[model samples]
Target: MNKERNQNFKKKKIDAESSYYYALSHEIRRKIIKIIGDNEFTSFTHLKKELNVSTGTIYHHLETLSDLIEQKQNKKYYLKELGTYAYNSLKDNIETIKAPQNEFKSSFLNKMMMITSKRFIMFHKKDRIYTVLISLGIIILGTIFSILNGFTSFFLFFIEFNS
Candidate 1:
């Protein structure tokens, strides 16, 4: 009887682990875990607003995440122990998860623009001076190019007028 009980317990544990990973498999479910974990508690309406998905979609993902999350009497959802674990894991490995795949080649200008935009959007305090200097350099170069182009056009007009 004790051996049978132990087998049952092991089976349930395996099921729980599978369910937890299954919940993490979907993007929406991961987002839900992050939202709830970050907020400690959140409402269905808040999730819907943040996700901007159809009601049915939210319902489906929430159902899948049932093992990870729980609702309180006040109708707010919060991460369960498993949910918290998932959230921490997700947070820790988010960079790896979001790393861009080299599926397509981008032009040098495109890569530069993306790098500059990302730096502008996510720079740290230590990078502030570097970012500002790079931005100023770009602006100065643009202004110089514009002025030179204007002079070139004026010189061409002057020559054409004389001709």
Candidate 2:
């Protein structure tokens, strides 16, 4: 019986730890942790206002974050011990966490704009001018072709009608 009880306690502990990590995985819950950690304590209304989310969203995240945060008799939410640790870790590593995302965004924009690489046709001023001239030349050629084709078709129809 003692062995069984020990096993059950270990299982519960593991489950709780998993739930704690699960709560931390969500962006909204992480924001909640940061907000409460920053203020030391905050009311539900304050969290709602700060997060700019619906009441239901706040409730759902608060429920999920139950293990990390708790409300006092004063009716404000405060971080529990684990929550404080999470807050500190997140605060410390925020730059490291965001660095890759920022880098990806900048690199993606640079690739899309083609402002950095000279291999693309529109990088230099001369290349841009050449591209514009080529584009206009194509448009003019296409317009002229269409006009000639239309006149030929009209002349054919006129001759066939008279015949």
Candidate 3:
């Protein structure tokens, strides 16, 4: 019985991963997954409005993702365990997918991000204090650089106007 259960679980996981890949293949489905995952529980009307799609269109996509999302009480939709797995996977990989392929550094950055994140996670598995600190530091530095760039651009514009 235990062996049977393990086989069942493995089968379910494989089936779920296939469904997830199919569901995420469409742009609308990906958008729907993101919104549903974000809101915890989303209504059909809310999804239609946010996605700017017709009721029929929403329903079509929902049907396509039927294996992933589950309808709840009060006309709300949420991800089941399998759906949650798919959503988490999508969230983890979305950055790589969303990065513009037209840019040369996007691939390099994505690879670097993956490598650094894996190392960071492994090293800080016990505690995330260092991770938080590093993230905060990056945000601060990015903000400072943005402000300086803005000021520099404005200064250059002023100089150009006076000449």
Candidate 4:
């Protein structure tokens, strides 16, 4: 009987340890526990808003963490035995999630896009006129030069034939 009781106690301790390990293994779950530790019994809406994670992701982590954490009567949460263990496990490494402000990187990218768009528009507008003028000039000059050269050659041939 003494041996059986000892075995049962060991099993229960192992189960609790395993649950703590599982909860603390994920970064998101660890962060969740830290948030809950600081403010016990927060709503799901608050977690979703603060963490900036999707509903599905929050729900999954919360479900896994619920086993470790304690829940209040109002479906709020507190630190159960396993939760306290997990919270302490990740206390030092818990990271706070903050939303990034619309900063220089995005503004710079938008400016670059605007500049490129304007340059392309200007090039398209001017390119047609430039191309037509160049083509017409080349055609006119070529025709005039060819006619002059032909007349000179014909006059030289006539003079030689008469001689």
* Residues 1-163 of candidate 4: C-alpha lDDT, one tens digit per residue: 9999999999988987787788878988887888887786577777788889899998888788867776677877677767776676666443422223333358776688544535444556657686566557866776667566553234234221221
Candidate 4: RMSD over Cα atoms? 18.8
Q: Pairs clashing in candidate 2?
A: none
Of 2 and 4, the candidate ranking higher by lDDT: 2
Please, what is the TM-score per model? 0.58, 0.56, 0.53, 0.52
Is 2 or 3 the stronger prediction by TM-score? 2
Please provide, for model 2 over 1-163, each residue's C-alpha lDDT reduced to its tens digit, 9 standing for 90 to 100.
Answer: 9999999999988987897789889999999999999999999999988999999999999999988899999999999988888888889789888877776467677676554334345457767876666668866776677566553234234222221
Stretches of candidate 4 exceeding 4 Å from the true structure: 92-163
- Count of backbone clashes for each model? 0, 0, 0, 1
lDDT of 4: 0.70
For all predictions, the C-alpha RMSD in Å is 17.5, 15.5, 19.9, 18.8
Best by TM-score: 1
Residue by residue across 27-99, what tens digits does model 1's lDDT show?
8898899999999989999999999999999999998888899988999998888999999999988766665
For candidate 1, report its TM-score: 0.58
Clashing pairs in 4: 41-77
Which ranges of candidate 3 are over 4 A from the true structure? 1-11, 97-163
Query: How are the candidates ranked when ordered by TM-score, highest leading?
Result: 1, 2, 3, 4
